[model samples]
Target: MPADDFSLRKIAIPAYGPTLLYGLATGAILPVIALSARGLGATVALAALVITLTGVGSLLTNVPATIVTTRFGEKWALVAASAWCALAMVLAASVPVLWVFAVAVFMVGMAGSVFGLARQSYLTEAVPVYFRARALSTLGGVNRIGVFIGPFAAAGAISLFGTAGAYWVGAAAAVGAGILSLQVPDLAVRSPGAGAAVSAPDAGPAPTVRSILRSHARVFRTIGIGVLLIAAVRATRQAVIPLWGQHIGLDPTATALIYGLSGAIDMLIFYPAGKAMDTWGRRSVAVPCMLIMGLGLGLLPLASEATGLLLAALLIGFGNGIGSGIVMTLGADFSPSPGRPQFLGIWRLLADIGTMAGPGILSGVTAAASLSAGIGATAVLGLLGAVVLWTWVPGRKAAVGSITG
Candidate 1:
């Protein structure tokens, strides 16, 4: 079959249901996580630490997660991960101690890494080159949709019960996601270095983490390093936006409204971005995404008025939307066919490190200088990410078929 004949519906529809549920589950908990910590009688500093544990937990799981993915395929791994997430949510709800709830959230994050890497690995295996971006971008879009709608669902649940009711929403989403995970098509993965996909039921004794790492060293050093910066910029954008809003003296409601609008704009363009990446090139998406986001954040500190802040926020959202699945898309593009899970485990670990550090970078800078200086520093890092992509990441034509792995 022709590569163009690869159906977006086939790649995307399978992921659509499960990812949405996962997104909802996580989203419902995110906004109120700190609140939950405080209600458990934790201090403000401890509550903040509670929120930080997720990224830390994700970092701790690469080895075990790789082992699980190696033994079980992506589909089974996702099901297991989602189920773990549901259990974690239930555990979180049951816990009275702040530390226990923190551990539960951390478990959820670790499970998320497995679930995420599995889906990415499966997509890399199943989707052809031409349709890859669209499929992955649509997955990102679906996730954004869930996040957008989840808070409202939590609001209803909260009104009927309480903040704890949101935990049930999270639990339900994980359960639903696990059930949906069972339905995903198990596309046969090809061996690393193979030109085309194959059944690979006996893909030669499944490779080890050490071997996969040594083989993909160049990619990890080059593209992998670049994505870390991308992740940092993305995380910094999230952290800085709210702080920036407050710096400009916007009310909480206005800040949320502006941010929400930006997110909506971001969600609306994922398909077009995927099309551009697949048809034109990865550079088309990556460069503009980084550049636009960098500029938006840099300009945000200069905006004193509500309208100006809104424009900057909207622009940043547009950039973020364009980059919907750019990281996963790049990972898929670079992955060794048979050992995707292992590579992705390490890949995600590195990226999450950047994400975990982004807030610290901003706070440190702001403490040392001013908010504008902090934002400028973050913006420079974002642009620097764009530069890294332009220099290191392959262009559209060159990117295709460049990696024998």
Candidate 2:
């Protein structure tokens, strides 16, 4: 296959459709999970815990998910994982008890672990080197599109049918994505002699997960800080932006709109960001992405009104949009083929830790000092991340070439 052809026509064209459906499920239910917990008689604190189970669920099962994906290949694993996610949504819709609902959300998270790792591993191998960045970045954008649209779908469902309707929206997305996943080929397990057709070279012995981790310890030690920082700041943006809007005295409706605007801008830049990373280099995208986010967070305290908040939000969104899949793209670059799934499972675990931590960091910092102080802290973290990317992330590009090349 021509290098650009697969990136432009084959992989992305097929992927965005299912991801949109999956995104609907992902996007729709998160906003309402706490409400659903509330209905189940959860305490205010417990409601937060219930909603958080989704990530907790993922963290619990990611390693097993790696083994499962490695055994079944990306296609079957995704199909099964989506089915599992759908079942969890169904349980969440049907159950009366809050604990059951929490279990359902946790299952959704576990399934997410499987689907995410499988998809990343598949993309790492299926697309050629030159096109890999473009493909992964586009995948990131597609997910955002789902997230961007999911809330509206949830709201409409609630507007018409009430809160349980939101769960149904999630169910449909999981089922639809599963069915669509079936139509995509199992690239990893294709027939013998087919490897050459797809340009898959024979890999050496399949390394144990531990051995792979041990071998790449230095790469992880050196590059992993930048990766962890990126994830933390991105999650920080999602949590901080809304809280800051509310802190500045905007009602929930206006806060939602500000966030919506950010999402729109972030979604718009996925392709271009991916293109630049593929064309320029990883650091080209990574550096500015963090710096812009840091700067945006720093400016949030200055926003006393909607226009000011939106402007800062837009800058952060643009920074995040351009980032697309900096972590995953880099993970793909670092993972050797022999044990890619295992390596990615660990890689994603560390990355997910950042996501889980971001909200807590913001919340704690805000409680300790002030919301302004919290945002300032993230700004400093973002700038520090930029410094790390510049100093530690290894792209000394003369022009648009691979750092590892």
TM-score, model 2 to reference? 0.92
Cα TM-score of candidate 1: 0.94
Full-model lDDT, candidate 2 = 0.80
TM-score of each: 0.94, 0.92
What is candidate 2's lDDT per residue for 1-405, written digit by digit as tens? 434445445665445666777878888998899998998899999998987888898887877888998888888888898899999989998887877888899999998989888777777767776777788888888888887788888888788877788888999988998998887655644322211111222566666778777877766665677787888888889888788888888999999999988988999998898889878888899999999999999999999999999999999999999999888888887776557778788888878887788777888998999999988988888998899888766573532212321
Q: What lDDT does model 1 reach?
A: 0.82
Tens-digit lDDT string for candidate 1 (175-219)? 999999898886654453222232233447676778778877777
Error of 1 at 25 (Å): 0.4
